[model samples]
Target: MSLSIRNQIAGTVTDVATGGAMGSVKVSVEGGELTAAITKDAVEALGLASGTSVVALIKSTEISLAAA
Candidate 1:
C-alpha cells in the first residue's frame, strides 16, 4: 500500500549512539526531536557528527503526536 506523507522536512544531527550493534542517531527538526535506528556501518559511512545535516523523512502513519 502507498502511504500519504509529505516528506519535506530537513533536520540536523544532534546526537549519535553507536555503542551497540546498531547505531542510533538523533535529529532535531521543526522544533522536534527524532531518533532513528540506523546501521553502525552506515553511521560510520556517513561520518555523522553533532552538527551534521540530515533529512528526516516523515512517514505520517509512522508518526505519533502527543502532549508531554
Candidate 2:
C-alpha cells in the first residue's frame, strides 16, 4: 500500500476493546505500547486483534518532529 505519512511505527497488536461506537486498539512497539481510539466499524473492517501486525501512522497539525 501507499501512504503519504512517514512516521509509521511497526508494531504488533496487543489488545482490542470495542464498545457501542468507539474502539480502542493497543499495539506493542519497539519501546512501549500505544493505544488508538477509533470507530467500532473501523475496528471490524480492519479485523484487528491480538497478535496482529500493524503500522501506527501518526500525522497531526501539532505534530512535533525531533531527531531520535
The best candidate by TM-score is 2
Q: Which stretches of candidate 1 lie over 4 Å from their true place?
A: 1-8, 58-68
- Candidate 2 on 20-43: residue-level lDDT in tens? 999999999999999989899998
lDDT of each: 0.84, 0.92
Worst 10 residues of 1 by lDDT: 1-10
Native-structure RMSD, model 2:
2.9
After the best TM-score superposition of candidate 2, give how far the Cα of residue 4 lies from its true spot, in angstroms: 2.1
Candidate 2 regions exceeding 4 Å error are 60-68
- Clash statistics: count for each candidate: 0, 0
Candidate 2 local lDDT, residue 55: 90
- What overall lDDT, based on C-alpha atoms, would model 1 receive against the true structure? 0.84
Q: Which one wins on lDDT?
A: 2
Per-prediction TM-score? 0.70, 0.83
